[model samples]
Target: MDLTDTVAVVTGASSGIGEATAKALAREGCSVVLVARREDRLERIADEIESDRTLVIPTDVTDEDEVTAMVEETREVFGCLDILVNNAGVLRVDPVAEADMADFREQVEVNLLGAMNTTHAALPVMLESEHADIVTVSSVNARHPAKEGSAYTATKYGVNGFCRSLRKEMADEQVRVTIVMPGPVDSEMRDWENWEGRALEPTDVAESIAFAVSRPEHVEIPEITVSTTDKLR
Candidate 1:
């Protein structure tokens, strides 16, 4: 999976791990398509990366039609899609009894269905490529249930299950499906000042994804779990 000149679409590229991943891929000479709701932030990142092969599509991953357009635009501009990074996601922490149903629903919509929409749209293009990769950014919550995270965890777990099955289904194909379940990371998703324990940086997770994608075409990395050395489940 040589990243040089390969087009990699990264959702939620406006910030956090998505931003870091986009820049990392650009540095590796991968053509990057940044998809997110914020066009201004995407513009800023594009300028910072200064990659001639960068495309910014302001899209809400929860919308199937927008995702389709994103993929189409990527194809139109890049002529090929090699990697799809389903990094678009959201999180909310609240107990079921006290949680707002709207927040829970938004979590499912963005984290679960967003991945479905983006992956569904990108799969056809990836399947056509000789060597392609689909990397899903999930969370440790998918494996361990944390207090006040039932709804958020449900979406993460749902993606984990879907990707696990898809990985097996595509085992014989050229397309590789890999899941990345990360622990607490220093990103916009959490407050760094209020945190008491260790947290992995966004680039830490980004580098791991890059490593997985850089592996040989004959190898398929099913899953990679990353967290700070001092941070335990």
Candidate 2:
């Protein structure tokens, strides 16, 4: 699908890969909707891009009502939606036995449920479009679990399952579903201090996302895994 003139809603657009994706899409001539709890950050990003090509919507994806309103406002402003990037996520790293229940809940709410809320709310508008795409920023942890990161990995696993199932359901609808899994990246969500190898930059993942959505209307990129060569598994 050509990104020119297309409208894309990118959740967690406040920072990291989400931020990069919003900018990348804008550069591709897309009308990008920046969604995140940080209105100020969203506004800052919006200012850097063409104002008319971006809409800043301060939203908490965990809230179903806010997510619904987000989609409604996007339609109200852009008239149609072409891409939905479910990128809002949180990571609470701890062993299962000692993990805080609240932290676990937070991860599940933001990483898993939040994606569902936006997808559910945006499906109608997307299906109405000539061609649409649902691209999710998942993690390599979804496939390879780590010892101390059970909760975070679980949420990603859930996200992976959801996207795969949704992809099958939308196979005949001209709506493409894709999952971009990245290894450790230097972002707000990760601390690279303890790492031995260089991490992939947010723009690396962003470029992958841009490539996936830019495919021909007949082709669908099911998944893309990006990681630094030194960081195995």
Number of the top lDDT candidate: 2
The per-model lDDT (C-alpha) reads 0.90, 0.91
Q: After superposition, how far is residue 196 of candidate 1 from its true place, in Å?
A: 2.8
**Candidate 1 Cα outliers beyond 4 Å, as residue runs:** 191-195
Note the residue pairs that clash in candidate 1. Answer: none
**RMSD after CA superposition, every candidate:** 1.6, 1.3
Candidate 2 local lDDT, 1-233, one digit each (tens): 56888999999999999999999999998999999999999999999886587999999999999999999999999999999999998887776899999999999999999999999999999999999999999998888776678888898999999999999999789799999999888899984333578788989999999999999998899999998988653
- Each candidate structure's count of clashing pairs: 0, 0
lDDT of residue 157 for candidate 1: 93
lDDT of 2 at 95: 69
Residue 71 of model 2 has an lDDT of 96
Q: Candidate 1 lDDT, tens digit per residue, 1-233?
A: 56887999999999999999999999888999999999999999999999789999999999999999999999999898999999988878876999999999999999999999998899988888889999999988788767778888899999999998988889788998999998888887863333467888999999999999999988888999998777654
**What's the C-alpha lDDT at position 189 in model 2?**
90
